[model samples]
Target: MLELRPNCECCDRDLPPQSAEARICTYECTFCASCAETVFAGVCPNCGGNFVPRPIRPENKLLKDPASTKRQLRSAPCGARTAA
Candidate 1:
């Protein structure tokens, strides 16, 4: 199951469970659309994989499988885009 991380790993922007702004890599490293597009250039910093929009769990399903409240942030700001 997707962790559906609560915030952008790069910019620490809030990304709620249903946020369309959330993007994730295959490894599920989450980021906001801005960071994923502009900062990382669609490439994941932690992994070399490309990013895609994170699936939003249905509201009812969220009650059974809760969206992760545990926030993750990068140790440092994602500065430069890495080569894909």
Candidate 2:
């Protein structure tokens, strides 16, 4: 199951469970679409993998499988440390 991370790791932007702007990598590293497109150029900074839109967990299902509240806010831009 997707962790449905609550915010952008790069910019600390709020990304609710249903946000269409959330992009994620296979490792589930989450970023906002802006960051994914502009900063990382569709590549995941943490994993060197391409990003895809994060799926929205249905509201009803979210009750049982809650979106993660643990925000992975970063102090520096993710693109600065691109995966080797």
Candidate 3:
């Protein structure tokens, strides 16, 4: 399952797993739409693949399994929010 990361890796914006601004690559490296579009040019820094909007984690589990709260990375937010 995706970590449903709480913040964008590039802008430190709250993602909350439901925000349309959240973007992710195949590896689920998270960023905000602004960063993904402007700073990254749709290419993930960690992975060269293009990004897509992150799917929202449901409020209630529809299946037996559920997502975990583990964070995969916490790199410094790239540059400034204005860049995003």
**Which structure among the candidates has the greatest TM-score?**
1
Q: Local distance difference test, per candidate?
A: 0.88, 0.87, 0.73
Q: Candidate 2, overall lDDT?
A: 0.87
- Candidate 2 residue-wise lDDT, 1-84, digit = tens: 999999888877889999999999999999999889998898887889999999888899999999999989666656554421
Candidate 3 lDDT over 2-69, as tens digits, reads 76776677666777755788898998888888888888899988878999998876667524545445
Q: Rank candidates by TM-score, best first.
A: 1, 2, 3
Candidate 1: residue 78 lDDT (0-100):
92
- Considering every candidate listed, which one attains the maximal lDDT? 1
Question: Sort by lDDT, best first: what order?
Answer: 1, 2, 3
Error of 1 at 50 (Å): 0.3
When summed lDDT is taken over every stretch of 10 residues in candidate 2, the lowest stretch is 75-84
For candidate 1, give the lDDT: 0.88
TM-score head-to-head 1 vs 2, winner = 1
